[model samples]
Target: MLITQPSDLDPASPGPITIAQPLLDHLAAIRADVLASLASGEPVYGVNTGMGALSKVRLTTDEQKVHQRNLLLGRAVGGPPWLPDDEARAVLIGRLRTFLTGDAGVSVELIQQLVAFINSGHVPAIPAGGAGSAGEIIPLAHAFGPLAADLGPKEGIALLAGIPGATGRAALHAARARRLADRLSEIGAGAIAVIGANRGPYHPLTARGDDVLAAELTRLRNLVGPEPDPRSLQAPVSFRVAGPVIAHVRRTLTHLEAAVERAFTGVTDSPAYLDGEFVGTAGFHGIDLAAHCDHLTAALAHAAEVSTARLHRLLDPAVTGLPAQLAHEPGPQAGLVAVHKRAVATSHALRRLTLPSAIGTAETSNGQEDVQSFSWEAVGGLAEAIRLAREVAACELLAVHQALALSKRPVPPGLQELLLAVANVVPPIEADRPFGEDLTRLLDSVL
Candidate 1:
């Protein structure tokens, strides 16, 4: 769908992107205001005078155009093949929003034209790992590739302020990963439910069952199944907590979903000229989105940990109430013993990846860059967290399936459907099966 448009932005989740009108409207307004101020010979910081160290110097009316034009031309020093599709769109739209308020003095048509280029798929190549301080100066160089030829006084600074390009790519990656985490937790929780293992930490209940308790209970009954399976007795309690565990993961997805929506449609602005007034504020800062992404990343990683713990329980005969690793004979066959090691390692690694990026900062770039939202880092980490979670979920599904098979008994009523769903694709293990092949089929339904 065309994410740039309001209609398109409404239904979408998150990922790569494009731009739409609010961005254009923003740019047009900024351009007109700057021009009007220039035409009136009013002394403004960027629109009429030199910038940075040179801001005190005033420009003549004719020189104002020269200065604005020169700012775009000279700062056009942005080196690149160009920015990636998603980042470019983010930058373009982000930059457009800045000017749209008429503070930056950028032309409306110019902003519209840039969005047009994006819609047409004219992606400029941008490099990775350009982590400079001072509001993503290096990344902005690549981000501004499209509008290189035309810039205003503070326009370049506005465009470069806080590398939203990197942030965009990171946001997209985080969103995709969080969804995978969601699915992983659901299937992982499902496996836990199948085994009936004792609950550990994460609960669906808040301290006050005031809002989500009933809602979660309703969801539990609706999604988990009607009765427990007897074969599922091998790991009795696993299927029960699946509801709340899955619910925790569900909350994370809800946040990621909102983040993705904003990836294309968010208008971060401060000092924006809304309607007819110059409204100065902090919308330009993306701390809110970064925080949301950070929270999701951390929560999803925990979800992975919860699932991995459940997979380990499958190996404990006392835990699963069945053969170790759900082995058929229990003595000779290794069963799921080694399989769980993978799950444990994967979960640990994902948890490590969950370290919040929003708090990351450094004093660099000649001290021009200090604290940072680290939004890009946060989003980038999310994708990794998501992938690891999928692997972990696959492990749980296999473990649960194996535990049920070794029961040598009927499956629990509630777990029966989930088991059938698994068995529909996976054959019972005899001596040993190709682990990879078994994992692949097992994950077909869950992962």
Candidate 2:
């Protein structure tokens, strides 16, 4: 894609990337200005002067020539646990956004090379761990350092600066979470139908005041079709509260999406060039992205909590009015008792990951760079949370399908297709052959 602005970038797509011509021309102009500033013996941070604590110290012309490449070498301290190619592409794209405003003082050639690297499908070995720097120097160095040769005055600082790593990963996760939320709609509807839950909570009146809730309510009603006779006056809390919980996930997803847009559009290079001056900036700090990732993590956990609880309720003969454990017979068959254990374990792990990563900060870099944001860790946690959430959703799907099969109640026409699909992979729990295999197959079928 030829990206001219932040809105042009799609987090879900990792196709070939190209910079817009206007931005390239802008980069050329900025590079010329940087050369002029260097010619006049002006001290540009990370160019003619030492970096960080040594910023006050000046360098000779020879040292200046080699400093840019050395900067990369010195900070490539992290190892192993690399980002996947798509994520690496997003990070490079995010880095390209930093240069789009012409504040990074890098040559158009350097930008073109970076774009070529992304388009070429070259995955920079950026460590997923060791995001301990106040800024992104450690991971950025590992990412762009290989391309650091022949760099210009401020190019190294341009490459070393910014939260592209965190923001890019967050953008990808936000997209994944959105898809998971969509899938959960189908699963939630299936569960409601199987249990003959009241549609009163999803009535049009309750959807008022929140657009996400309204949309989810509509989706549920469509998937569930006309409601059956209520199993009771009210279904369990997990079923009744699903609309709002999913709305909360969607709401926090909006927050993450907004933060990602801001990160890509805004200038994030430290010591950014502005109107012929090299000025220091804190745009590299990524607490905004980290905090929003944390929020989404928490939201997914809430959704999972509801999902697992609903799964447990599905097993209750009292709730579904089916045989205990959704089994063919209570005494001889184990039914889905084992699946609930896996969901419980997965739910516990998901909850443990909800701790705010942004709050787990510390100082580093001899006080020159301190107060780390732990943005990378937050994005990583969000990725794992999404994984676990999907697992929980898969477990719910198994229960829903099993409950639908066991119940004598009429299945909604809207849910018939879903039931057929699930039943194909997960056969009826006729005699309780290993259900772990069923869950694995169901995950493949549904997810």
Candidate 3:
């Protein structure tokens, strides 16, 4: 697809190979405006003057070009563990989307080069850490430094302005998390039915006016098929509140989608040319996306907690009406006891990752850059949280399948289908054996 607007950029969508003509026109117009402003002897922040704490220092026309090159080279301080190829591709796409808004004042040639970079499958070596600036200067610089020779007046700051690294990473994580959230709903419903949980908590009457909750109820109904008699008067809170918990994660994904869309479409360059004048603003701030990432982390943590609790319920004989740890024999062989312990550790680690990274700030760039949005860190934490949540969900699914097998009760058609799918990769746990590969295979098959 041709790159033109924010909606065109999806994490799962293929990268664009060509730039739209309208975007090219906008870039030309912006470049003309920038040149005219410089010719008028107006002292722009990055065009004619030094950046950050040195903004007071005036630069001659000849020195201004050199300054732009230096900006890219000087800011390339990203550390080890380069971003993955897919993530780097996302960052490049995000950066190109920002330029399409025509606020960056970059030349058409520079935009074409970026497109060519993506088309050629050349992933920039951007580090996964050390982005502490007000804007994503360190990572952006590393991603764009190779093209410094092509940078024009004021283009360096424009290139570094938008929070592409954080925004792109967040977009990728949000897409994956959203897909996993939906699959979790299906798997969770199967688990609930296997344990004979009360259906009142997921009844339509319980779904207030929230659309997400209503939709979750419908999905639960489809997966659970028909409600059996309640095993206990009231199921555990984890089982009862599963619908609400998944609803919360769905809400967070909606907010993140909006935030990421804005990051792609909005003009975030400094010294934006608006209303026939260059105005300095905080368009580069990444708090909008940072806060959304933090919320995603919290939502994933809650899901992990619920999954862990459900796994615990499946292992208890009193709760599941099965042998301890779903063991074929009570005490002769250890069944899924070790798997439950691993789920516990995974959930606890995810809970620890729920701390918001936006709150951690420090003064840098000689105190000129204060109150940073640690958005990159927040997205990184969210990625880890998603991984742990998936692992926890995998454990819950394994336990639920085993519990259903031990009960020897007739299951809903939906749950029976799920069991058959799981059985394809993971056999019934007859005796104690290494289940590490089984867990991985189950997660891959279902999620």
- Among the numbered candidates, top lDDT falls to 2
* Residue 382 C-alpha lDDT in model 2: 92
What TM-score does structure 1 among the candidates reach? 0.71
1-447: candidate 3 lDDT, tens digit per residue: 875654565654575567678768867987888778778988899778998999989998789878888888999977789888888888877787777777777788888888888888788899888988888888999999878886787788878886877787888888898889877887788778877887888886778888889888877877787666778878889888888899899999999989988877666778877766788878668889989988988998988888888888888887777899999886898889889999999999999998888786899879898888888788888888888999998898888878888998777776677678888898878898898888999878876
Q: What is the TM-score (0 to 1) of candidate 3?
A: 0.95
Query: How does each model score on TM-score?
Result: 0.71, 0.94, 0.95
Q: Where in model 1 is the C-alpha error above 4 Å?
A: 1-30, 40-105, 127-134, 150-155, 162-178, 181-185, 196-210, 226-245, 252-267, 274-281, 327-333, 358-360, 364-369, 404-446
What RMSD does model 1 have? 5.6
Pull out the clashing pairs in model 2: none
Q: How does residue 39 of candidate 3 score in lDDT?
A: 85
How does candidate 2 score on lDDT? 0.84
Of candidate 2, the 10-residue stretch with the lowest lDDT total is 5-14
Name the regions of candidate 2 deviating beyond 4 angstroms: 408-424
Per-residue lDDT tens digits of candidate 1, residues 13-88?
Answer: 3233455566656556556665565466655555566654576688776676456446544443445344446655
lDDT (0 to 1) per candidate: 0.56, 0.84, 0.83
